[model samples]
Target: MKDLKDLTAIKLKAYTPVKSIRTSWNVPISDFARLTHNPIRAIVEGLKIVPNPDKQLIALSIGDPTTFGNLKPAPEVVEAVRRVIEDGSSNGYGPSNGFLEAREAVAEYVAHQGAVTPNDVILCSGCSCSLDLCISALAGAGQNILVPKPGFSIYRTLAEGFGVECRYYDLMPEQNWEVDLSQLETLIDGNTAALIITNPSNPCGSVFSKSHLKAIINIAEKHFLPIIADEIYEHFVFPGYEFHSVSSLSEKVPVLSCGGLTKRFLVPGWRMGWIIIHDRDNHFRDVRKGLANLSARILGANTMVQGALPDILRNTPTAFYDDLVSTLYRHAEIAYKSIKQIRGLRPIMPGGAMYMMIGIEIERYPEYETDLDFVQALIAEQSVFCLPGQCFEYPNYMRIVLTVPEEMITEACKRLTEFCEKHYKMDDRIILQQQNGLLARMNQY
Candidate 1:
């Protein structure tokens, strides 16, 4: 009749509910572990658990560009790495903030935004890691952080795991995914520590205009919250639009801008990214110290990549970027036009990044229950893969990457179109009744 509390911490393993007890030294998983796990990876794994030999799945799920296997790093960057291997200095430990040379290079690259120097840059494994560091440093247990509703889920994942709550602010899809200022102001309270924004956003893919960027800055300044600008897609804007850094517009508020070599350099595996401290007024002195303390525990980015970064930043030809961005522009056009051609699916033409957010009309396609059901059924039938809006915490929508080669994208769209055609329905009532009944009928080839 003795309770489990009577046992010591070490002996408490015997109180485990399962058949087996910890006979030796054992550890239990933390509640935070489940929250911290990447939902994207889990979804991908869930979809792949069962192997269908007949159906060929075309992946547009993961955002890593290198998965295409066609895009390669600049020759100079490869050569620089080769040289680093020969020299063997970068093979050893370097500064925690980053190699001074690498920081200087990132400083020079981002200097166009504002006055920047090597002292302002802190490098990490990648933009994701930099974001993790920033979010963890800024907010502690029980505090709240404002994030975009359809934003990258990692912010929420990490925030929740760290015991910080995440509050979502709506982005107006009708107005090209701009933040709803009124909704944003309403979400703020004393517990809110920082506001996270992704420019050239993921999932939403809409780049903020200079005016909008200034408005965001003004709001942050008014509320005294530092901005975590996720600028990983910096300079990835298409023909008509330009990427503007929020930090460039003002000096009153602090900006911890995170970016990486992943998208722009076309080498995500390089794992090199940095945080640029844009505190022109020295307002973030304590924040910078917190970042320094956290970064010190992790050391820095890949030294070989760090060694190559300077050459990669300075020597990469202008034509290289021009061609890459232009190609992305064309792909975005193809995706936008193709999505428009399809009934019941409305797509917002992206200004930058490589994604387009497509709004799904569930009433039009009553066969599927939600965006997740739509994509799952699409993959099951047509073998076309896309992340549902649920992955980004915004349901009734789906996100597709347009940066894949044009022919591949065209063909994927063709398959997506076929999938829609296969399940097309004029009447929602019949489709509703047929959810289980007609689903099999539609799946029949």
Candidate 2:
């Protein structure tokens, strides 16, 4: 044997690279872990990566309202945008807070909810951007924010990226997906900065009742945390349910009410959304300043969307909104009926929005180990592409978009039932093993 030091040197030299790269970049990506788990993007990419050629893909993957033929913006709304472009009104830079008229329109719109005014509004690109701004403005790194579970993933994503802690409270499915107030209270602490509420919720489509909204306001008031109400689906109520804005519920708690022209007006690509600082007694000046600073950093939302907003708000016919709601109600009815007949799937009838969640009896499917496995198998065999419940941070369920054509809903449900029949058998041991494995994975995380 060689000398001990010489032997160590020889071992190190054996692993030399063919080439070397040099750089001064020392900071690691702070948000890399959170960014990698964007389910929508991951699912889209997964579809592209699959080598199989015979996949019958019916994408109920994302919540884009325009895919089904709903109302496009009115002709007058389009003309307003065209006029702004032709006149070069939006060709140059605009105020960081947004155009005065656009902000005024947002203010007036929020005013209709009860107590908000134009002075409270700040326009941003969309609700996503508004949420980011609000999170950044109000909370710094290592602080905590409360979010609803089986809810919008963006709130968790944004909070994590900013190094803010995200604490989740349950939206109990048994109780029509209402926010669990006791859970909310337990999740809040001294470092908590804000609480988020999504009216006409995205995944569940459950609208909060007036009594529930008031109770939420009381919770916020007791905690001294500002409320971030995402109302993008505000007016998309079904036949029997009515939409309530959080600003309408209280004059006591400070609310950062966010809404967009995307879902209700059917113009998502337009990219115009607003954040209104609803402080009835002038208590949120610091929060307002923080928002202003954030807006200043990013500049304003799109000028073209901003320019047309006044007309979009004022001139869009009431008939258009009424018809849109009626169409959605009909689609919801069709989808609900279809889902009800399917074996091993349970759907709570949605009251608002264009999506519904269906609980999957994992025990019913012997081959499925989790909701993701069930969804993947469904896509491979039946060509149906519903979102797995785990994608929305809820396991043992899947979400279906009701925006598909009425005929497609019937066909999709039929395929789903057949798929379940083909794969599932009433085998107790297999299900217990799968559940044990799933529970182990959950506990590990």
Candidate 3:
């Protein structure tokens, strides 16, 4: 044994570095770094350090409707949820697909747009969850999904986390944020699983025209890929613009319609959403099964919300929805008007939803080289916060959620203008050098 050991140990191999453990721990931080340290959060965090009660900050970073006094569901919807909780009927676990009545209500609600049936709908936690489940069910690692540039950040983040490549299709700003069909067509290939379209888009806030929806469907048909239609902001259109559901277009194409109670009903915290397979040609049977399986795996959405669906859908008066639309329209108008006065920013009038993208004239402001830098600077100087364009994949742009109090919008825009004006004269070499130094220092830690 000693002789064997001596012979084997004659020469030992040098220790090789084990391939770095390469944990996916940094994915969340890396994926959402901007959001994690979002200027809004920084402002709130900084406010926590101050002892003053008179000075409060205004937030324009999130699309929460509650800040605008859009609280409480319609009386009918409230009573519906109340009845369920009071009777304890919905306390127990319900069907994984959601209660039949809830599914039926969803089907009827969607049917007003076009032909959709109960078989087409699957209730989920929220629009975000619906997107996650749909993406998971359709594609996997190495597969590609086409998303709109300057679109919802969540889609890109979720798709990337799932190892799916997010190929961006440009939304033409000059064309009222319509999908650039040629650009979209070029991005699709055999490996592409789906194309996600956010109608009344998240950050851009432009609603798709009927022609635009048709063009998108044609592209999906040409590529033989399914369509994930995010219509969470479907009914939030302004007076002139109407939201056209992709399902209203060619039933030949498989449309996975994603929607929820959050935007229209103003109860985002409730987290009730649905994914309907609007496959008139029966092309999405496999995709539908996959979605159903995913839904089952996640159990089901909130039973109280699901139980409230029937009343929410059937009982809530059209007057309530009309009022909601009118309120949002007024707020959008106020925001658009106020932002126009800001020198370095230009906003596209949003047709629907609670957001608008303002183009940052970086050339006009020499102190800021990027949208993120500009936004952070504004937050620090004015105590007003907004999401940078890069968050939505739009460089040199920023998104302002217009759901804040109408009075605040005026002041927010005023501060923004002041900040831009103060920093506008950076042609001097000294100022430029100082800015670079400041940016470098900020990036260091």
Candidate 4:
């Protein structure tokens, strides 16, 4: 219809050109990328701390029970995974939520969480992912979630990653790290979306009793807010102390409990965790749908691990947990008694979990201004590494894992005592020494 010259001119005029690619990198990172800082990694890794060159380092910093080779999963737990791999049942893709059988197994195992069912279970990569799903599903930009002060840093990392605000409620160290109900209530306003309760807490190792748990649930019920119960350390309580799941204590409040095989089975690398919905009243009607949608993003957790759930949950003997708890209990006693003798450090006796929080009389250590400075000095002079409280958003305190071998803990405490004595202010050291002597004499009676 047109001449060749006219057609060529028309094509050239209509043609669109793409903007040229930039010569230099100027990509903008999303707010999630820029703001999602894990306080633990940031504080622990950011500090270029080097241990004493001359001494063998005794690290009480790691929370993993398997780090020192003193702990291992039961044989049946490993064999379950092996059987699943050999059977090839889990080789194919599973439902986005999880395999039905795995969900059922989890439901039955966590029956204590209050009448769970397969439909209510969503398998996740680990407790961390389970927590992420809960945080992202329940809270959104401009809303806030109440977290414990001196709490696990993962909550902040997950919340900020989703643009959710984290408001901390103080946990009283003097009251065995119990939640300050008054403070917790004050943190809640219309913008508050949920509350996170970490029982047998990671940094505190303080397990909530049934009554104490009920008190917390009452607050949630009163505020008409749901709860994100991080129960990864469930049932890890030492003897004489019982561990109660926050979900179990709730009747009116909906709870999304995050738990996993990572801690209990001592197979953290397996990355198997679950969320059990305990809505009872269907408060999570939309939340359940939201969780399912979020899970589709990852296509679900490892199928092999899912397949092993039934066997691992049913076959593992009770004695396995009993023995493990007994070992941890003994370790706790040893560390508590040893650290109690240190002049400037006051150790909080943990009731459960494998960690203890020690309060430092920073004023007594005149040379060090904060827990970080004190911890750095401890590592340099004594080759003993303890996590500074700044890692948990608490200052002038430190946390140590009780999962280390007994002899290592004993030796580590000895070193800690020596280091504290070296830097302790002269007058306070003498006064504390007298107090320690008086207490030791009183105990002798």
Candidate 5:
């Protein structure tokens, strides 16, 4: 028996040394598919195998406020949900567009942005789902939508999945992340369906100025395209900046404004969001009908949440909102200052939103090859997680969410500082090479 066991162990070791499972299997795969799942989550999952002994893992990757379980939703909002459950009438499927009251509630909430009515509103599970409906309805196969670079990945993912081309336009980081209107105009053609822009821009975190917004609207009008406004981060701007509803600003081109209770209200779990059509000239008659058709297929946002929408929109105290904005402002400043202090990282101080895009001086860290590699190494060495810029179609940069607790953010920054100090190098040649490489990538993109 002992001799047999030894022989078995020898055979197992020999088998391990040889490559196993090399069979060709025909599996169905879609050419249009892209990993649209949160790339931030993907990074965190990949780093789970790396052992970290010195520091506890501090994840600032996800933008979910509820993840920490500290930031509470409004008392009024909670009461509304409680009342919804007690009433028990909201359990059934809502209207295909949304509950009438909920649609009317959303329409009134953003009524400041021109005239909006219940007929102009369509609800969905979340802002993301709302986007999916909008883009899918607007663009068919072989059509294209112009998206902002260093923006959310979902735009590309959703468009590609729907067999629509993803056209990217650059945002000037030096100019408070405003759109390069010239570049934007050049990307427009007959097949272009719409222009999508995120105010209080994601990844960059720079809010569009009123002038910038007008310029974008003008460009959209000139090219005869509608606007898809991702204003989920609306009203989260800091003291110096103000949130402008694109629908409120545009008079000619129709604006499909998307927003939810996720960011400002801190009720992401409710999964309630809406799209309000602002067609001053009724340019989106067909588009609105298409949106209705799309909404019918998916039903609508949570009926119970829809029941609470009235209170969530109207009754949440103004003080709660002030406090929320104050909290975000403080954290953004802290993150900005911390990244500024770090030797090899250059961050564009965000004026809005809960993110700051920090640029990695690749030449300063020769040990790492790319931003993705740098982020993976940071996770392995310090157990700190942040999203790489490549996930947003840019490289050598990282997007950090400032929604976490102050102490955790500070600790993560400390770990990042130490990581950079440990891997710091001085090489000008590497910078030129990286610049050339980035140029090549941009050209290809």
Candidate 6:
């Protein structure tokens, strides 16, 4: 053998980039992998979109609040995270459920959920993960879960991925997206495992009142079903409305309430969320253990964030949330007012959350076969993209995110007005109505 230095040089000189080998082997994919799909991603990515070169693209399709950079976390939140990192205590693995202190912080933060404690809380990677754990723990193969139509698509994505069936109950948009109680009752059967209620709903953004929530719980009480409450948008009610957690109203029903710092904290990537088990009669005693077992699969959420939880939950000023909600409320008004003025579109005003759904009269725009076609054409011409209703299993409508900057919201509305005017086919009845309105305006002058 050569000397040590000479041997090292020889080894370095002998190194070569390995090339990938071509193999004839074909591995079969599992049914689970093949069957699991995200409808939003599939529909959005599958579109052959070509935006207009003259106008810049304004994407109102994403749900993230920080997408526009107009919103940001408070200094206290940042400082807390920094302190956690500097202390170096959070670098190691935490308990599978979560750090007791972190869980305690979450419990205190959501006290409105009724007597929440560290043991009642299980931290997850995010609200989506919290939801996943709840769904998987509550339901299994060949079982069914009832979800709202025109609801967030994640429930379907998670439920179906685990071989559980998702049965949809109708939400009457005209009734501020309230669940059709009669229809909801009919969907439940022997195989139904749980009922999913997304208050301050994602697509509709309609917050159900306390009475409505109580009515919903009554159904669950009667059916002997557990509830998976997606309250990630908790306390985000508009000025005129209030948000009531499904868990808070239930006396007998067990609720796995999912929430996190994703939206309200302006930190989606932080991946901090928790499930508050509110089982009044100890219905979720086994589920508490089940969630603990499920959490073990991912270990836990980010350790540093968990370390920062106490400060983040308690120290962040209330003013920050008030300002954020004010901005979103203003943006909601701008979109709703603008879209309401546009012909062939009926804008449903949302009580809270960061989205607005506008109904499309496809008959008035006969050139397009569906809402997808209308949105694609809007993207092609106006460079403004909104999510088609098909993503939520609701047709003849589209959803627009309200977290974009104000100027962009104004510009988007202008572009939408122009696009709708160009494509909207006014029938004789509409033309006559417009003429009459013009005469009334002229008479007033």
Ten contiguous residues with the weakest lDDT in model 3:
46-55
lDDT of 5 by residue, 3-75 (tens): 9999999999988776556488756567655434554445546654463777788877787877886578889
Give the TM-score (vs. native) of candidate 5: 0.87
Candidate 2 per-residue lDDT over residues 1-445, each given as its tens digit? 4699898888878987655555766655656465435555564455422322564556676588778564466677788888888888787778888988888888787676775566678899887888888888888887999888898888877777677887888999999999889888999899998999998998999999999999988999987888888888998898778888888778788888888888878788888888888787878888888888889887888998888888889888898888777877887888788777877888888999988999998988878788888888787777888888876779998898877766777778778888887876766886799999999999999
Name model 6 segments beyond 4 Å from true: 1-24, 428-445
Q: Which 10 consecutive positions of candidate 4 have the poorest summed lDDT?
A: 12-21
Give the range of the ten consecutive residues with the poorest summed lDDT in model 6. 16-25
TM-score of each: 0.89, 0.86, 0.83, 0.91, 0.87, 0.92
Q: What TM-score, to 2 decimals, does candidate 4 have?
A: 0.91
Instruction: List where candidate 3 sits over 4 angstroms from the true fold.
Output: 1-55, 67-70, 426-445
Please give, for residues 76-162, the per-residue lDDT of candidate 1 as tens digits: 778878888898878978889999999999999998779999999999998889998999889998899999978898988788888
The RMSD of every model to the true structure, in order and in angstroms, is: 8.3, 12.1, 11.2, 6.3, 13.9, 8.7
- List clashing residue pairs in candidate 1: none
lDDT of 6 by residue, 261-376 (tens): 99999999999999999987888889888888999999888898999999999999999999999999999999999899999999999999999999999999989999999999
Q: For model 4, how big is the CA root-mean-square deviation?
A: 6.3
Superior by lDDT: candidate 3 or candidate 6 = 6
Error of 2 at 390 (Å): 0.9
Model 5: how far residue 228 lies from native, Å: 0.4
Candidate 3, residues 338-403, lDDT tens digits: the string is 778777678899999888888888987887788877877776678777777777778898888877
Off by over 4 Å in 5: 1-51, 428-445
Report the C-alpha displacement of residue 46, candidate 6, in angstroms: 1.6
- Full-model lDDT, candidate 3: 0.80
Which regions of candidate 1 deviate over 4 angstroms? 1-26, 47-55, 428-445
